[model samples]
Target: MPDVTTSVRRRAFLLWAVAALAYAVDLGTKLAVVAKLEGRTTVSVLGDWLVLRVQRNPGAAFGMGAATTIVFTLVATAVVVVVIRYSRRLASAPWAVAFGLLLGGALGNLTDRVFRAPGDFQGAVVDFIAVRDFSVMNLADWAITGGCALALLLSFRSSPMTGTAGASDAGAPGAREA
Candidate 1:
């Protein structure tokens, strides 16, 4: 018997640690951008498709929402909570990694909201990754989007989160074939 009370909280800790790291990296880079670029500079990564264009965002994803950084901050907090809650239900390492990335992104943006510029809790997020004529974004945003995509793809596997029938539940008349 592997008699141990170590618990499986390592997964949860990993999720949070990844979040912290993402947040730190984002914040540090944004600070550096503000110091060096001073909110007006561009470094082309792939011609015009991907560029490191520094900018500040005071809204939700893709610069859709606006001005209400406080509201966005609240939403970020709620998202972090939900991510943590759902992460505990993950049974696959891939799923965990995906969720961790999403959580990390959220935390990163949230940190900016809570710490940088304007007011105490009324600060905007720093976005630097630019794509042609589209809105500027940062690494955290990419991680969040990518992780969510991965999680959705993994949902069709063996998770109870997906209502679709898997291998064991295949061809049960009422269920569709796997």
Candidate 2:
């Protein structure tokens, strides 16, 4: 078996690699959507089930808190900081991937908030990809949502961030069966 440091190094690499890829994809898609769909009529992609349109949402999911763009920017910055700090002890592949997606998504939106429109840290996020009667969002939104879902699943399964069941299973009655 590899040493602990080696394992951690590998996991950290995986986390950052995934983060870079997710960030790139989110940024690329947003640029494309803005260039092609901005100011244009909504185009149906799946016959009303899915449509493409450009919208600048200065708010949270579903465009909530439209007046809190600066707050959101600060929150996103905090999230990025927490994720970086947590990565030091990353030992689970799933957790790494989840955090990676979260980091990428946060950075993507934060970029827009810092340098997109009406001023610094008060700009709107570019949202495209309307889903029928649902909300209009972008790739970053999907990444964040997916990461949260996976993290929830891992928690439900009692998966530890350390990638070991050692302490978590200790309290169970039959955990020490000989």
Per-model CA lDDT versus the true structure: 0.71, 0.85
lDDT of 1 by residue, 1-178 (tens): 3212222354456666666777677667877877887556578799989888777788876776777778988987898898877655444456666778888888888888887777677678888878887768887887788878887787666354322222244544444444
Model 1 residue 53 lDDT score:
73
Q: On residues 26-57, what C-alpha lDDT tens digit does candidate 2 reach at each position? A: 89999998888899999988999999999999
Local error of candidate 1 at 152, Å?
1.1
TM-score of every candidate relative to the true structure: 0.76, 0.90
Q: What is the TM-score (0 to 1) of candidate 1?
A: 0.76
Compute the lDDT of residue 101 as modeled in candidate 1.
83
Per-prediction CA RMSD (Å): 4.9, 3.2
Candidate 2 TM-score over all chains jointly: 0.90
